[model samples]
Target: MSNPYAPPDPASRPPKQREHTGPDAPSPADGGPGPGKAPGRQGRAGRPERPKPTPEQLASVSRSVLHFGLFMLAAVLTMQVDLPWHLMSLAFAIGAVVVGVRALVRVFKEQIRGGIVVLLVFGLMLSGMLVVTTLGSLAVWNEQMERQECLRSAITVSAQDRCERIYQEAIEDRFGTIPGG
Candidate 1:
């Protein structure tokens, strides 16, 4: 007795044939492989169609890169100068903000890694700006303190003490304090 689920012998069935009558029909005239299966299908159901990046994405990426480079250049110029011309530092700060914002826009446009780099760099630059600005203010206040010595000699004790307190507070504001002192 034969099993009910036994496979049919090849001799008992006709040869298989390709059908070209439906939506999955092959374009044989274009030299494709055959019906239903194309040569490009490497695995299950072919790769999903991905939307290409828009021109806006490309522009944002380029804009952010340019502004980030500008920020770096401005940072070097500001840090190495003899005089504390804060204009350059301010420009660097502005550049950092611009680059970071542009990068954020790009992040929504499928450029995650690039956007993150821009944001991190901007954060570093802003932190450096805080330190540098504080140092510059300290220098300016120190000069005023030196110039005000003539007033200290002429003023009342109370006025002199007030002036001294102002200088002390300025120093503390710039550099918090030594560990113990």
Candidate 2:
């Protein structure tokens, strides 16, 4: 009448293999909770635990974070076409590249496994931002300077408005119609 698939009765098991009876006892598959079990380690076999990262390795990973932050800042700044924004974006992009280089060096020297690929991606992004911002600024340098000067000297709303119109004309002349309509 007993089910054949049911587990064998613990009472009939050998003394060493008997499942311990307690709320805190582990399952039989885990070798139970008693002298039969190896404490402080799992019975399941697989890869051994990995070693903790040294301070230098951790610092290498941290550099990636700094690189990512600088890259993000540069990306945001690059969206603006103004002269100062272009300069600032270029600066941030350069800083990101420097940080990425340091991160890569540390990763190689310390033999860390992660963060290198991400740093390379960030490096490419920063490079693109740098090139775009630099070329864009160079292309509009004179017009940007004139617009900045006019805005700086203008004291009235009408003069400030006139500065915008002049800037529009300058841009139109440079690129044959301003972008974004």
Candidate 3:
């Protein structure tokens, strides 16, 4: 009887080869490099480098910058307007708290230097906003006070004039003072 336990003959066995081809081939450095070249040199050359800064990324950056610039401009305009000092301070404090929290989160994520830079920038922005708002509020308050004082003075003068006229009429009626006619 034939040897039942013997291994199959090499000539009769299927050729050793990968099942797939083309782009399906693994990269040279990682695995079998098929379609184009030998596995050793496939990833080393011939492939075009990827383009930098995709359009979406560029647009995102532009939008972020525009938003930041607008925010800064608004803050500057607020400085010229009448904002309350206490309210401004409160808003700045809130902003600072938010920035601190974000920075802490970044730090926890192993971005310590980035967190510090962000914290510094946010702190500066908050401070600037507070100052602008505070100054605006003070200016508005002063203007209101001046207007009130002017109104008060005008009322006082009018009241005094009316009092003088009434007193004159009473004297004329009491003493029959039509002598000038």
Candidate 4:
């Protein structure tokens, strides 16, 4: 017995019956145009021809994709917890926003349909991240600067220790101790 899940053998099957019998019905031999398809719609392989995208649409899509990648990179960078890297993350977020806006504008002007939703969503998300990072960076700015200056002038390990102590004190003073401690 044949396996129930296996495909049927084409050679043993009867020929397909055409649904339409009129004179205008598509010919099976030549794979003539089907219903709703005009003769001119077929391309080289009898498939419908698709319209090519314009250069503007290509640019818009590329920019939108780039912004998405940049935004993700910024989010990862922000988690590094280093001041310089946080600044770099801020820069990446800013660049993402700029690229996203350009993509949105191009998509709107050219009437491209593909990347508008991506641009809008990532643009808003990147903006919120940018503001949050900027504020966080500002809050730590003075402490970081003082620590850096202190460490820069230190010729010995003890002075560097002093800089770290000051930074810790400033942070604890501003943020208070851990709840359980």
State each model's CA lDDT, in order: 0.60, 0.69, 0.51, 0.70
Error of 3 at 44 (Å): 18
> What tens digits encode model 4's per-residue C-alpha lDDT throughout 22-117?
787666456766664455556666666666678867876776766666675776667466566567666666776676666667666665565556
Predicted model with the maximum TM-score = 2
Q: What lDDT would candidate 2 get against the real structure?
A: 0.69
TM-score of each: 0.41, 0.50, 0.28, 0.44
Model 1 Cα displacement at 174 (Å)?
Answer: 8.5
The digit string of per-residue lDDT tens for model 3 on 1-181 reads 7697998787897667554556655654555554545444433365633335556655554454344444444444544433342444545444544544444454444323444456457755665556565655554554444444455455577765665565456555655687774
- Write one digit per residue (lDDT tens) for candidate 1, span 60-171: 6767766766776676667554334644665676666666665656666664454466555666567466546746654675545543663546468877777777766667
Q: Candidate 3, residue 149: CA error in Å?
A: 6.9
Clashes of 4: 0
- Regions of model 4 farther than 4 Å from truth: 1-52, 63-92, 101-131, 179-181
- Clash pairs for candidate 2: none
Worst lDDT window (10 residues) for model 2? Answer: 40-49
The alpha-carbon RMSD values of the candidates against the true structure, listed in the order shown, are 15.5, 13.0, 20.6, 12.2
Alpha carbon lDDT of residue 142, candidate 1? 56
